[model samples]
Target: MRIDYVINKVAQTHRGQSEGDVAQAIHDQLRAVGVVPNGRQIAQYANAISALPQLPPNATKR
Candidate 1:
């Protein structure tokens, strides 16, 4: 699943933290999982998170 979907679901399921908090938790979890290695990688993750709606998946024929 996309990160934002996962984050929104986590936020809803948690039912207490703000959306930002949920996003942060996902970001941290990603880092812990070696999804990112450094600041530049984090930037890539940030852009991915921010543009979740606008960017279409490359999996679609293009």
Candidate 2:
């Protein structure tokens, strides 16, 4: 599975959600698909997603 793509997609869909909320969403989604990530991994994914540059309000994804 392409985890980076997953993270980005989750971040986009959950925009304006809290970091923890987003993390949990990612965790749940992965678990549904049988990729059970632990809490630390979820936190790491959250941190990595948070570190990405934010787009302008009117910006569109390519």
Candidate 3:
């Protein structure tokens, strides 16, 4: 799954929250879009993202 995309999408509205909090936000958004992840899977993605390097910028203007 595109975990990074989901995490960043959720982060736009939930700044300054813990990874767990972010994970929950992501879960809700996914559900809203009818994409239900496995139980606790969002939290797992959140934890995984925390250990990886930061995501690159969305798209730079020329």
TM-score, per-candidate, Cα-based: 0.35, 0.61, 0.50
Against the true structure, candidate 3 has what lDDT?
A: 0.66
Q: Write the per-residue lDDT of candidate 3 for residues 1-62, one digit (tens) a residue.
A: 55556667765555445677767877877777668676577777666554555555569755
Higher-lDDT candidate among 1 and 2? Answer: 2
By TM-score, the candidates rank as: 2, 3, 1
Comparing 1 and 3 on TM-score, the stronger one: 3
Error of 3 at 31 (Å): 0.4
Report RMSD for candidate 2.
3.6
**Per-residue lDDT over 1-62 for candidate 2, one digit per residue giving the tens place of the 0 to 100 score:** 65656776887776555678778888878877677677888887777666656645765645
Q: Which stretches of candidate 3 lie over 4 Å from their true place?
A: 1-5, 11-16, 49-62
Q: For each candidate in the order shown, give its overall lDDT on alpha carbons.
A: 0.50, 0.73, 0.66
After TM-score superposition, what is the CA distance of residue 49 in candidate 1 from its true location, in Å?
14
Q: Report the Cα lDDT for residue 46, model 2.
A: 79
Residue 21 CA displacement from its true place in model 1, Å = 0.5
Return whichever of 2 and 3 wins on lDDT. Answer: 2
